[model samples]
Target: MEPQKINKGDRNKIYFLVIVIAALIGTNAYLFFKDRKQSERFVTVSAEKDKLRLEVEKIEVELDKVNALNLDLNDKLVEEQKLARVKIEELKASLEKAQITQVELDKANKQINELKTFVKSYNEQIIQLQKDNLFLKNSRDSLQNTLKNISNKASNLENENSSLNAKVKTAAVLKLQSAEIIAFRTKSSGKKVEVTRSSTAEKLSVRFTVIPNEIAEKGHHNIYLRVFDPAGNLLADEGNRFEADGQEMQYSHSIFINYNNDNSTYVIDWANPKPFIKGIYTVILYADGNTMGKAQVELR
Candidate 1:
């Protein structure tokens, strides 16, 4: 390297070039950070909007369920449902924005809370109406029986001729001689096999036989099946109720069969949508307002 004398003009030019390069680097870094923060904000807003939309969807589903119940909804509930629909549409429109602010998110949350309140009140009213209707029906049925008894006393001698035949019904109740239950699981190819583990079991098959009795009535019979989990909770697709032993009770499944005084086997399948627990399950079958049989199954 040869040592050369540097002029003032050349030194000034070198200083200017260094300053330009530093400025470009600083500007690029600032721009990169700003873009990253903006992207993160957009992602957060999108996630929040998705969560809010799910809440609205839940309310919409509940509304559909109430309407499908076919209950006689009062004026207030109907109006509330109408308001909920309108608000749901409004929220959908608000969430359609590409960028949602904190204020908008808060507002959507508030609206969803109000919609939840409407759904709760709507459900409570439906329950109350169902209970009232059931009570009225039971009372009317009881009164009619009472009136019939009072009016038929004058014909007691005539009724005595059929009393023997009527007494036969008491002995006509169907009784189960043997019952069996099995659990199964389905594979990805849709093949099913018996399973011993609760988590793998998806369905249960129940087979029962009625005891042969010469005096038993021959006609249609309704059999209600109850399956209780290890926690004593009934597993049912829907909370269907029926009268058994003079009381209304929930059933897990139901079957209908015809009896001809001959011992015959019947089969019914129960598919529980939820996962089963590993413990003993109690299954009780009922027919003719009496417990026909009870069986227990334990899973690993």
Candidate 2:
């Protein structure tokens, strides 16, 4: 077949159609590439937003932990807890933006780092407080123990003092030995002789020996003598009343003697102001608040 030759008008129409088809294909390719690029950008932005949200959640969790700790801490840690919570709130508010940029995310991340540092500092403080409390408790216990020991020692000293006082009191009592009583008659010539008749008796004499005791005290002592008739009548002199065992009683006679912690004999005499009518007279001697000895004298 011979090649067909087209005229100028037909060739122009064919060239226009070819150009229109190339334009349509180029427009489709451009639209497809633009749509794919837009979708990729959307995915990247969405992923960044989700990651920032996760970072905010992490910060919130840490803040919650700090808040929980604040509940258990003392008033001293309250301000720190409040500041940490404020930081968390500020970070969360920043994340509420419609579009989160990388710069903003970085800023939030810095705030989180600050919050973490605060939490670490709070933990250290709590640890130190616990240590201080333990030290104080130990000191208090030690002080209590020392006070208890001192009290015990003081009590022991008091008891020892009491015991020594008792021993000294016991050692100071005087001992008495042989006792004698005699009735004598004094004549007009002032000579004394033993008398058995009551009509002739002028005086009654009492004699006693205080035994030597090294433990007893040496001092001036008052000796009291009491003489009683057979009818239980006390032969007391004027102004001879004294105290003995919290009671006042009359003594026949009293004499002051200087004790030297040696065996010493004492003689006490009672003059008969009236006539002696005693069948038997009892004589008692007292010294240093105790009975020293007793004796009896007989008269006809």
Candidate 3:
């Protein structure tokens, strides 16, 4: 077959078509490569954003732990957390951009590091606070124990002083010695003599000498005398009672005497109330709530 040759205008049109096709293919290849590079950058940026989010979440978890401590800095912790959250949101928005420069990434990382530092500082504060609280508690307990010990000692001392006072009081009681009871007869001429018989007795006499006591009070004291007949009969003024040895006792007679912390003699005389019985009479003396002495007299 003989080939037909194309004219010059048609050839020029074919050359333009070929050049346009090559330019279209080159443009498509450039667009495709540009889109692929942008896609890769987006994936890297997305990964970095997710990683930063995880870091923020980790800091939030640490904040939760510190909050559970219930420390005094909890209010500040909350405020710091609020600011950190805002910063995290700002970082999230920044990282969401299609392209992040190295400087911008460095700034984001710096913000994250500041947040981490805040958490670390908060943890240190909490630990130190706990240690301080423990120390204060120990000091308070120790002080209370010391006060209790002092109180106990004071109470013991008070009791001991009271006991000593009681002993001193008991030791200061007056005593009598060399005591005697006698029966006397009074003559018409105002003379007194020992009775020859019980019927002849006109008066009963009691004599006692106070023993010297340095601690006993020096003052006028009443000496109580109790006279009992041998038949257990008390010859005394009826219903005449006084306190002696912590009990009420009847006294046949009482005599006033000045005691000067020295041996002092005293006498009490009572006219025979009735005829004296012919037997032994017992005489008991009391002074200062104590049985001072006892004496006896025989009459017939």
Candidate 4:
């Protein structure tokens, strides 16, 4: 009996020890799993923080580029505005110059019309004078015929009248060549003027010829030439002598022959030290105190 009792107590003790060991192992496994989960959460949070930092840096770089581009665009816009302003000013000045030129042109046209009217009046007066002279000749012939029938005293008178009639016919037949402009040629400093893209100083040379009449007298007569710019403003050069006529004229660099000669040519040169812009240029010439011809030239 004593031995049985001791064996039972030993079995109970072993079972109790097995149960306690199982409980201790379960608690240890729970603790280890919780620690591992916390470590994984910490690693995830650290990775997310690093990614956000990189994204911020990229955004900052993009913003800086955008700011730089804006600055460049602003500078370009300002430059464009400045250029536009300058162009506007230039346009205004050109407009004013054009207005003044128009007024001057109108005045010149009026003067030209007046000159034409005067020429017409002169022609009418000459025709009237010729008619009167013819009438007088007829009346003198009748008187001479009557005198011849009466006596021989009209013989010397008839001879004087005949001589006077011959002189009148000779004077009436004298021809005058109308002043005419022949040709216009342009030249630079010493050579022919040419357009170039490069910025350089240049000169303009004008050459004109006068057409003379066959009956022009061989005497000293003054010849005049006038030049105007595209805007109709007088382009007078140095060494030009002013003469009769309501002409604000500058003489060309050279003159060839006097009036009352046959077909003489004249040349004038103007030096422009500034760069010439591309445009149309107009030139006019006058001879014998009248506008004889005109020409147009294009420079590019």
* Model 1: worst 10 consecutive residues (lDDT sum): 164-173
RMSD in order of candidates:
37.6, 7.4, 5.8, 44.3
Per-candidate TM-score against the hidden true structure: 0.48, 0.57, 0.61, 0.29
Give the poorly placed runs of model 2, Cα more than 4 Å off.
1-133, 197-199, 228-250, 272-280, 298-300
Clashing pairs in 1: none
State candidate 1's TM-score: 0.48
Candidates sorted by TM-score, best first? 3, 2, 1, 4
Among these predicted structures, which one has the highest lDDT?
1
lDDT of 1 by residue, 1-300 (tens): 989989999999999999999999999999999999998988888888999999999989988988887877779878878988999999999998877789989999998898898789878888898898889889999998888887787478568757866667656667789988889988999887999899888888888898887887678888899999999998875669888777988899898888887777888888876888899888899888877888778888
* Deviating ranges (above 4 Å) for candidate 1: 151-300
lDDT of 3 by residue, 39-92 (tens): 898788778777877887787788778768776665765687688778767877
Better of 1 and 2 by TM-score: 2
- Cα lDDT, all candidates: 0.85, 0.79, 0.82, 0.51
lDDT of 4 by residue, 1-300 (tens): 455455788999999999999988998999899999978865765554444334334433433443454332346445543553453344334333422343443443354344345445544554565667778889999998887776665666788788987665444332222222222234545445444322332555555554445544455544444554445555556767664346555754334355544455555555543344455555555444545555555555
Model 3: residues with Cα > 4 Å off, grouped in runs: 1-112, 184-204, 222-256, 269-284, 290-293, 296-300
**What is the lDDT, from 0 to 100, of the residue 14 in candidate 1?**
96
